[model samples]
Target: MLSRNVYPQTRPGKWSVLLLLAVFSLLIVFALIVQSGQPFNLDTLFDNGWAAVVSILAIAAAFGAFIVGLYTIFRNHERSAAVFFTVSIGGLVALFVLMQLFL
Candidate 1:
């Protein structure tokens, strides 16, 4: 039997699992973009491979931020959680822009 508090609590390894899932998703999107052969360029970065790399990094960073947010939330660190969430969203948007420009 699980207590209500336990049910509401975040699992210790959940962040890592979520990060891995996000990585996999990003990889799939990268592969798809590579297959499409579309022209993408923004601010000097032009190669398809490099674009993919930047996108993957951005996604990973965003995922890391989200993980931090989760940790903050679980620990009742409201301010830090808000900051992490904002950064995570910003990273995601940056990734999208990079994809449009370079991939």
Candidate 2:
């Protein structure tokens, strides 16, 4: 009989679920904007101020990191992507707090 056992399958942890929820919420907001007939253009973004611009980028980076993390988990057989995704999401949240506090 063959002796070696391989192919272990692990369920994604809370980080994946949390990141997906955040991404979904962001998409919903965008959909609302579209439905309201509000143009989400660069001019509107610039009108919001530097804090808003930076916060938007932080959010986008967090979302992109999450997606990359999921892809890495499935394709590259490495877990380091989770670290990046977690860090980015944390930074996004911290930026939000900072904006609420100071801006």
Candidate 3:
């Protein structure tokens, strides 16, 4: 017998899922752009290891945001948490696009 709480909670609202999917799709596009070999040098911090540093920092920031968002959601602040997560992810997607565009 599965308790009510044992099952995963119902998925978020349709708009929420749609918004997330859109953001994720944009991320994929940005990744493809980066992988397409467009010549643009945006890394000025580390001439030799800029790529590695950028990748690490980006991943760390995303992980941190996800942890905070998950905490907020589990603390009964789903609305705010969703907003935070969405905004964070959206910002990352925009950054990726800009990087690919200019760099």
Candidate 4:
């Protein structure tokens, strides 16, 4: 079996690994939704003006989560997982930006 050195092989690894996975998945999903904001009708976006504000804040939160996740992974000495999170988060961030700028 290909061992995933992505997470620590310690007693705390099980729960921490699951938590990290959840964070990464949430970020990816949020990024995809933001990238494909087509489903979010801009026309109705301001229907509750604050809804749009909340959505913007949600994007900021995802960015915050990405940074926090990176710090957490490295602090746990999960070097491989740190690299994986970096690439995953960075790529999605880039995709989100491109989609916003070009589409």
Candidate 4 TM-score to native: 0.40
**Runs of candidate 4 exceeding 4 Å displacement:** 1-47, 79-94, 98-103
Per-model TM against the reference: 0.36, 0.36, 0.35, 0.40
C-alpha RMSD of candidate 1: 10.1
Residues 9-57, model 4: lDDT tens digits: 5433444444445555655655665566455556665554555565555
In candidate 2, stretches whose alpha carbon ends up further than 4 angstroms from where it belongs are 1-48, 81-103
State in Å the error of residue 36, model 1.
Answer: 19
Model 2 weakest 10-residue run by lDDT: 4-13
How far off is residue 27 in model 3, in Å? 10
The residue pairs in collision within model 3 are: 40-103
Worst 10 residues of 1 by lDDT: 3-12
> Top TM-score: which candidate number?
4
Ranked by lDDT, the better of candidates 2 and 4 is 4
For residues 9-88, write the lDDT of model 3, one tens digit per residue.
Answer: 32432234345555455456546656666566746535435444544455444444444444445554455435455546
